[model samples]
Structures are given as structure tokens and as C-alpha cells.
Target chain A: MKISELSECSGVSIASIKFYQREELLPEPERTSPNQAQYDTQHVDRLRLIRALVDVGGLSVATVRTVLAAAESDIPMDWAMGVAQRAIPGSVELPATTTRGVSEIDTITETLGWKVSPDNPGRGMAARVIDSYVQLDHEEILSVLPEYSRAAMIVAAADLASVGLQPSRMRMSETVVVGTVLGDSLFAGLRRMAQEDEARRRYAQVQS
Target chain B: MKISELSECSGVSIASIKFYQREELLPEPERTSPNQAQYDTQHVDRLRLIRALVDVGGLSVATVRTVLAAAESDIPMDWAMGVAQRAIPGSVELPATTTRGVSEIDTITETLGWKVSPDNPGRGMAARVIDSYVQLDHEEILSVLPEYSRAAMIVAAADLASVGLQPSRMRMSETVVVGTVLGDSLFAGLRRMAQEDEARRRYAQVQS
Candidate 1:
């Protein structure tokens, strides 16, 4: 197949495909002639994965590059998934001096008996939420942390189980990255629906 | 206090506060002179909310404006939060003719007895994840939907309970908006940590 076919099949623009190639998100294809290059099934699959990361997963190109490299590495699936999870774009930066929020989050993780790295961006990311809540004088919001973590554990277990069912290492890595990134939106979307359900049930008596 | 003071107290940059002001994300402070405007505690609080939405919640200024307006409305908290959820940036646009994903999502929502509005962006957002998965020939990934939805219900219940703890209508509205936005990242971050723990446990045999 050619670039145009790849574009048509993947539904990604040629310019984006070129941009991805330049950004090293996609690999260079074989040149069939001075002006033509031939792409293969791998290119199609790679482009689809790239689109899934950027479009659905909302990962930055650099992060996607790093994730792709990790996927291609000989590292264990667990480590590859961890790398991809850390590379997620978390814009909420915590001040290095704020030990309280971090410690509070660690307490929840420890009580849950979950052993994650001290440097997992997830910890800092979760801590940022607590910090925001505290900043607003709504520290009581932390009361919900345990429940959220329990629910998170359930979802995470199911996520890993799904990844475990994949047929190949490459597919597992792709699922890990996509599931981590887009799964947020998926679960958030479901949460909205669930909230609507719960809110309706709670308000029915008031309305009645 | 002035804009500078509000910025100083909130730790948000003056330029961003100005940008939010210009974007109508924040209401105008009272002008005491031709060149000087005085802000108050409300300004500080509002600035923090704006920063939380933009920085941590990853909402667009336009969406923030809509959400702020929703927050100020006399509408029920449920409706206001719905508006905010619908205004979130879901960049993965599906073709207008694409009904398969929407109906597939509807099936899940129906099965769960959720009563969300047809136009709820959460529906579309989650549908986009499904569409991406199907596009990549990983439809089996939907196997995790039930688990994710079940977990989402737990978190949503906690989320609403936290909001119910608020003391005033205004504070309730604020919590609704903040929780809806920041809560996504918070859960996602925790999910990552939870995933690490679960993966560690599952892969322990391989590592050992």
C-alpha cells in the first residue's frame, strides 16, 4: 500500500501522517521509487495505534513516542504499562515542598496495601486533587478518597485482566496504553451517567 | 484587594487571571477609579476555581465560561453538573452518520438504567473510546465496560455524597463543577496507581 491508501484506510490525513513520521511517531517506509514509498500492514497498524493514542487517549506526541519505544522494547508488559502510565500528560504540577498531600495519599495507598513506585506520576496526580480540595478549604473531600481508591482497584484489575487476554506482546502494549489513556474518558463518561442516576434517585423524594 | 492581590493569594498568574477575565470565565471586579479595580475574597476563590478547571481539570476557557455560568444558575445541581460535563473538550469528533457507537453506548446505559440526556457529551466521549477500539479491531476491549461502569458507580456515589455534604447552594454548585472536572483526573491518577499494584500482583509469578 501507499501513503494515500494508508491515509484513506486509517482515516488520518496525509499531512498528519507526514507530521507523525517527522516526529518519529511513525517509521519511515520503504521507497519503491524516487517519488513513491510503499507502506505495509505494520504501517497501517502503527498509524492506527498512533491515532488511538493521540485522538482517543489524548497523549502528547513525545509521550506517545516514549510509549511506543517502551512497547517495542524487550521489557516486561508490567514495566511497559508503567512507563506508558507515567508518560500520561498530567499538567498539575505539585510544589516539591508540599509533603503533606503526598503523605496523605501515601496513607491511602499503604492502607490499601497497594505497592506502587514512590515516583509514579499517579501519586502526584492524585495528590494534586487533594491539594486542590484543601486549597478550597474543602479538605473534607478527602473523605471520599478511600471509596474512590477501592473503585479504582476494581477497574484497574479488570483493565489488567483485559490486557492479559490479548494475543500478542505488541497488542498487549497497545491495549495497556489505550486502556490507560482512553479508559479515563470511558470511566469518566460512565461516572457522569452513574452520577445522573444517583442524583435522580436522591432528588426524587425532594421533587415528590 | 486588587487583581494582583487576588493573583498573589490564589497563586495564579496575573496574565491568566486577566485572560480568564477577558474570556468571561471570571466576573469583573468593581472599579473604584478610572484605572483601578478592586477584587475581593470572591475573586480569589473564583480565580482558584478557574485555575483548577483550566490547569487540573483540563477544560477549555470557553467550557469554563459555560460551566461558570452553569454554576451560577438557579438550576438544580444535577442539571448544572450535566451542563459542565457536556461542555468538556472531546476532540475526537465522530462522523454525523455514525450511529453504531452511539446505539452501542445506549445499550449499556439502558442496561444500567441510567437516565442521562441524549446530548450528554459523556455519552459521546465514551462512544469515541468504543469507536476507536472497534476501529483498531479490538472490540474485545468492551469486555471491561461492565467492570468499569460498576466501579464508576461507586465513585459517582461517593462524589455525590461529598457534594451533598456542602453547606450552601453556591458551595454545592462549586463542588459539583470541581468534582465533575477534577474528579476525573483524580480517579484516573488513582486508577494508574491501582493498576500498578494489580499488575505487580498478577506478574509476581513471572518476576519471581
Candidate 2:
């Protein structure tokens, strides 16, 4: 297939395909002549994955390259999961001085028996939000930490289950990366709809 | 309180406070002299909200201004909720030609008996994710839509409950805005931790 066909089939523009190739996110095609190159179905698939990661996942080119490399490795699923979680923007490393928020996250995870590592970027990410709540004097929101944790467990189980359903390790790796990134957007979108629904129910009762 | 005191009290830097003032996300303080102004506790509170929305929530300065204005209005909570939902980045308006994804989302929301409006940005946001799944040929992951939706409802209920706990309407409005923004990050971070725990449990068994 030609680059134009790759663009048409994968729904990514030819310019983006070239950009990804330059970024080393996509592999170079076999040269048919001085200027012509031939792509294949694998290129199409890779382009689709790259588009999903960049457009929907909002991952940077560097992170996407890292994730793609991890996904294509031998222990693809495990490596992809780690790479995807770490690639998540804003999952910063905790400053050594910030123990209070991290400790609160530890307490919650401990109560849940999650056994998550101390250095999991998620720990820092979650603690930062928790710290914001405390800083703003909205500590009451933390009261629902248990419920959020429980809900997270349910969704995580579903996430892993979905990954498990994939027929191949490669597919599993792709699912892990895509699900980790797009799943956040998916759940956030659904949560907004649910919030509107809940708000209407509660506020309607108040009016009635 | 002076600007410096406001920054100290709110934990936002003086420069950022000035930026917020320039953006009109924060109201002007009372001018005490040609070069000095007097800020009160309200300014401190406002700065905290602005920081939460920008830092934790990742909202843009323009959106923060809109959300703050809505939060300060008479029918604050309702307006704040609506504004915050719309302000969420990546909640693009669906093309009119696009009906399949939206209909799919409609089915899920309807099955859950959620009375969400068609125009709700969340509808478009979730639909776009669904469309991405289809485009990537990873539609199998949609098998967990129900589980994700269920978890979203759980978190949404907690969100509204936390907002309801606020003692004043203004505080309620602030909670709605902050919760709508930060809640997404909070849940995403926890979900990552949960995924790590689930992967460890599942894979550790395989290794054993």
C-alpha cells in the first residue's frame, strides 16, 4: 500500500504518518524506488494505534514511542502496563518532603489491601489531588475516599478482564495501553453524565 | 491582608495570584493606596479555588474564569456544574453526521435509566471514545462498558454528596466546580493504582 492508502485506511493523515516515522513511532517502509515506499497492513495497524494514543490518549510523541516499544517487546503486556501508567501526564514523583498526602494514600490503599508499590506514580498522582482538597479546606471530600477506592477496584477488575479477553499477547498489550489511556477519558465522560443525572434527581426533590 | 499574605494564606505564588487577577478569575482587591491593595479572606478562598482548578483540575485560564464567575453567581451550584462539564477539555462537539456513537452512548445511558440530555458534552465525549474503540478495531473492550458506567455512577453519587456537604451555596458551587475537574484526576490516579494491584494479583498467581 502507498502512504496515501495508509492514510485513507488508518484515518491518519499522510503528513502525520511521516511525522510519526520521523519521530520513530512508526517504522520505515520498504522502498519500491528512489522515492516510493510500500506499506502494509501492519503499518495501517500501527498508525491506528499511534493515532489513538496521540489524539485520544493525549500522549506526547516521546511517551507514545516508549509505550509502543514496550507494547512490541516480548513481555509486551506487563511492560506496556508499566509504561502506560508511568506515561500518564501529571503522575509526578512525590517530593521527599511531602509525606502527609502520600501517607493518607497509603492508609487508604492499605485499608483496601491493594498492595500497590510505594513508588507507583499513581500514588503520587492520587496524593496530589488529596493534598489539594486539604489545602483548600475541603477535607470533607476525602470522606468518600473509601467509596472511590471501592469503585476503582471494580473498574480495575473490569479493565484487567477486558485485557484478558484479547486472543494474543500483542493484542493484550495494545488493549492495556489503549485502555489505560482512553479509559480515563471514557470514565470521566460517563461520570459527568452520571453527575448530571444525580444532580437532577436530588435538585428535583428539593424543588418538589 | 496584603497580596503577599493572600499568597501565603492560599499557598499560591504572588505571580500566579496576579495572573489570576489579570485573567479576572479573581476579583480585584480593595485599593488601599496608589501601590497597595487590601485582600480579605474571600480573596484567599478564591485563590485556592483557582489553584485547584488550574493545577489539579488542569483547566485553562479562560475556563477557570468562566467557572469562577459561574460559581459566584446567584444560582451558583447549578451553573457551576453545567459550566464545569462544558469546560472539560476534549469534550468536542460531535459532527452532525456522527450518530452511531452517540446512539450507542444513548443506549448505555438509557439502559441505566439515566436522564441525560443529548447535548450534554459528556455524551459527545464518551461517544468519541467509543468511536475510537471502533476505529482501532478493539471494540471487544466495550464489553466492560456496563462495569465502567456502574463505577462512574458510584463516584458521581459521592461527588454530589460531597458538594451537598458544603455549608453555604457559594461553597457548594466551588465544590461542584472543583469536584468536576479534580475528580477526574483523582479517579484516574486511583484506577492506575488499582490496575497495578490487580495485575500483581493476577500475574503473581501465574508466576507461582
Query: Among these predicted structures, which one has the highest TM-score?
Result: 2
User: Taking the candidates in order, what DockQ does each have?
Assistant: 0.54, 0.53
Q: What TM-score is obtained for chain B in each of the predicted models? A: 0.77, 0.80
**Looking at candidate 1, what is the lDDT of residue B25?**
73
Query: Whole-model lDDT for model 1 versus the true structure?
Result: 0.80
Error of 2 at A202 (Å): 1.3
Query: Model 2's lDDT to the true fold?
Result: 0.80
Tens digits of lDDT, candidate 1, B79-187: 7766765665653454486565677788989998887776766777788878867877888889998998899899989988998898865566667767877788789
- Candidate 2 residues lying further than 4 Å off, grouped into runs, are A1-43, A54-80, A88-90, A205-208, B1-43, B46-80, B87-90, B205-208
lDDT of 1 by residue, A1-208 (tens): 8889999988889999899999988878999899999998888888888877777667888888888888889887678878777766653555587566788888988898988887777888888877878876778778889999999999998999999998776677778877887788889878877887888777543653
For each of the candidates, the C-alpha root-mean-square deviation to the true structure, in angstroms, is 5.2, 4.3
lDDT of 2 by residue, B1-208 (tens): 9988888888888998888788777789999899999999889777776776776567888887777667667663555577766766667687587565787888999899997867787887888888888878888889889999999999989998998888876577668767777778788889989999888877653542
